[model samples]
Target: MGFEDLEPIFGEPKVEWDQGQDSVKLRPFLFHVSASDPSHLRIHVTDFHSNTWEAVKSVVQLEDMRDNIGIGGSWSEFVDYVIASIKSEDLKLVMEGHSSSGGAAYAKLVGQKLKGMPLISIPLTKLLDAAASEAMANLSLELFKAFKNMQHSLVEEQEQTFQLTKVISAEKERNETIQSQLDYYSKRQKFQKKNATDKADVSSTPMSNGLQNSPDKLKAQEASSTKVVNRVVPAYRRAKVRGAFLQDAEDAKDS
Candidate 1:
C-alpha cells in the first residue's frame, strides 16, 4: 500500500499541500521500534528527504515486487515477515540523532507500541574500533598474498638464472674445447711448415756453396785423356823399328 495506509498504525504523517499547482508532498518521518527487555533487537525506519524510499527502490524494483511480496501477501505482511525473521539476540540497531523534521509526535506514538523496550545506544568509538580492526585484518591478508607472490616470483627468477648460468657455462666449456683444438691444429700446421722450409734451405745451401757435383762429367773427362796417351805411344814404336832396318841395310852394302 502507501504511507497513507500506515497512518492508522503510525500516527498521522506530516503533509505539505500546494493548492496553486494542485500537488501534495508528504514530509519525511522516522519510525522506531524495539522489543521489551535487554535483547538489544531494534529497527528504525527513517525517510529523511525520501532517502529511505530511494534505497528500497534500488533493492526491490516495481517488476520484482510480486516475487518478493507474493500474490496473496500485502506490503504490510511482507514488512511483518522481515521483522519476525530477525532474532532478538542476533541483531543490534545503532541510532543517531537527526535534524528536526516536525515528526516527533508520530515517532512517539510508534515508540509506544512496545512498552518497556528501551533504546540501547552504542558508542561511536566502539563502532570505529570494530571497523578499524576489520580494515587492518583485510590489509594484512592482502599484504600476505603480495609477499607470497613476490617470493614465488623471486624463486622463479632464481631458477631461471641458475638454468641460464648452466647453459652459459656449458657453452663456455664447449668454446674452450673448440679453441684448444684449433690451437693444436694451428701449432701442428706451423711446425710442419717450419720443417719443410728448413729442408728447402738445407738443399739450396749446398748448391749455393758449389759443393754439388755430377758423376757423368768426371767419367767423360778421364776417358778422353786415356785415348790421347794410347795414340802417342803406338806412333813412337813404329818410328824405332824403321831406324833399325836402315842400319842393317847399310852394313850389308859395305860388306
Candidate 2:
C-alpha cells in the first residue's frame, strides 16, 4: 500500500518538499515501534536523499519496518497494534542514536541542537488524553486540599465566635447583678430618709396639738408664773403691849 492508504488511519500528513535534496518527505509516517518500551514509538521515514526512484518507493520505505512488521499481519494490523500498545501503557519516551563513536561525538558537538524535540511520537489523540488526565488529577488534589483548609478555618472561626458569645453573656449577667444591687441600695436610702422625716414630724406633733387644744390653760399657767416672780413681802410690824395675864396674877396675891 502507498502512503496515501495510511491517511485514513493516521489522518492527513504534513508534506515537506526538499528542493535541495530533490526528495519529497511526508510525515508522520510510522518509523519504529519499541519492543520493550511500548510508549517509545517513533514516526519518521528515512531514505537516501534522492529523486531517482519512484515517489512511492521514496516515501513508503518498507525496509524500515522489516523488524517490527510481523510476518503474517498487514500494515494496518501492525499500525493498530502499535496504537493499542501505547494506550495501554503509561506515557513515557526513550531515545537512541546510531551505534557509532562518531554519533556520540557528533551529539556532544551539537548539544543544544533540537533541544525541544519530543523524544517519542504518539498520536495527537493519545497525547491529548494523557494531558487531560494528568491535569484532572492535579486539579482534584488541589481542590481536596483547599476544601480541607476551608473546613479547618470554618471550625476555628466558629470556636472563636462561641468564646466571644460566652464572654458577652458573662458581662451582661454581671452588669445586671450590679444594677440590681444599686437599685436595692437606692431604695433603702430613700426609705431611711423618709423614716427620719416621719420621726421629726412625730416628735413635734404633741406640742403643736396641746397648744391648739388648750391655749387658755397655757396662758393661765404663764400668768401664775409671772405673779410669783413679781410678788413682794412687807417687813414685820413694831408692837409693845403689856400682858393682861401679869396684872391678873398680882391682884390675886393681894387678895
Candidate 3:
C-alpha cells in the first residue's frame, strides 16, 4: 500500500498543523497506549532530534517495511528495531515513547524481555546527602579497583618467587650430583695411585736372601716398605681433604 493509505492506521497527522488552529500540518505522530494512562494522547513528533547515540541509524536501513510503520525512519526506531530483532519483530501497540525506547534498549542489552520493570536510578549528577550509604558505594568501587590491581601484582610476585625457588632447588640438586661424582672419581684416583706406588716400591727392592747373608737386602726391603707407606698414606689423606672440601661446598650450596 502507498504511504497515504497506511497513514490513517498509524494515526494520520496533518501535514501542516497550525498552532491554536485545526490547519493541516506535516508533523509526524504515533499511537500511545498504556493501562495507567489509557486516555493519554501523546503525539509523536519526528523532528525532535535525539540526543542519544541511538539516533544515528535510519529505520529503513535494515528492513524494507520499517518506513511504513510510522516511526518516520528515525534512528530511535532503528535502534528499537535492532533490539527487537531478537524476537517480537512485530511492532505492537506496546512499543511507544522515550521511556519505552529506553526499555527496549535495556532489554536488548540484557537479552531478556523486561516489560514494566521498575527502574532504580541512582543519580550521580549531584551528591545530595553524603551518608554512609553514599560513601560505601563510592568506596566500594574504589576498593574494588585497588584490590584488583593489588591482586594482579601479588600474583606476579608469587610467580617470580616460585620460579626462584625452583631454580635454587635445581642448583642444590646439581651440586649434590657433582659432589657424588667427585667422591667416586677421587676414591678411584687415590686407589690407582696407591697401587702404582706399591708396584714401584716392590720393583725397586731386592729379593729376600738367607738371614746370614741378607743385611743389605733387609735394609733395602725396610726402606721400600716405608717408601710405599709414605706414598699411599699421603694420597689417602689428600683424598680425605678433597672429600671435606666437597662436603663444605655442598653445605654452602644448601645454605
Task: State which candidate has the highest TM-score.
Answer: 1
Worst 10 residues of 2 by lDDT: 104-113
Best candidate, lDDT: 1
For all candidates, what are the clash counts? Answer: 0, 0, 8
Question: Is candidate 1 or 2 superior in lDDT?
Answer: 1
Tens-place lDDT per residue, model 2, 1-255, is: 323323211111222332342242332211222221222232322111211011112213333442333323675554454344333323222212322321111111001112342222332212123443443344345446667888999999999999999999999999999999999999999999999999998887778677757979788889999999987754455343566444578798998
lDDT against the true structure, each candidate? 0.42, 0.41, 0.38
Q: Using Cα atoms with residue i matched to residue i, what is each candidate's TM-score against the true structure?
A: 0.35, 0.34, 0.31
Model 3, C-alpha of 219: deviation from truth (Å): 23
- Tell me the TM-score of model 1: 0.35
Candidate 1: clashing pairs of residues: none
lDDT of 3 by residue, 13-77 (tens): 22222233343222332221111122221112121222111111222332343444334556544
Query: How many residue pairs in model 3 have overlapping backbones?
Result: 8
Model 2, runs deviating above 4 Å: 1-127, 204-208, 211-255
Q: What is the C-alpha RMSD of each candidate to the true structure, in Å?
A: 20.9, 21.9, 30.5
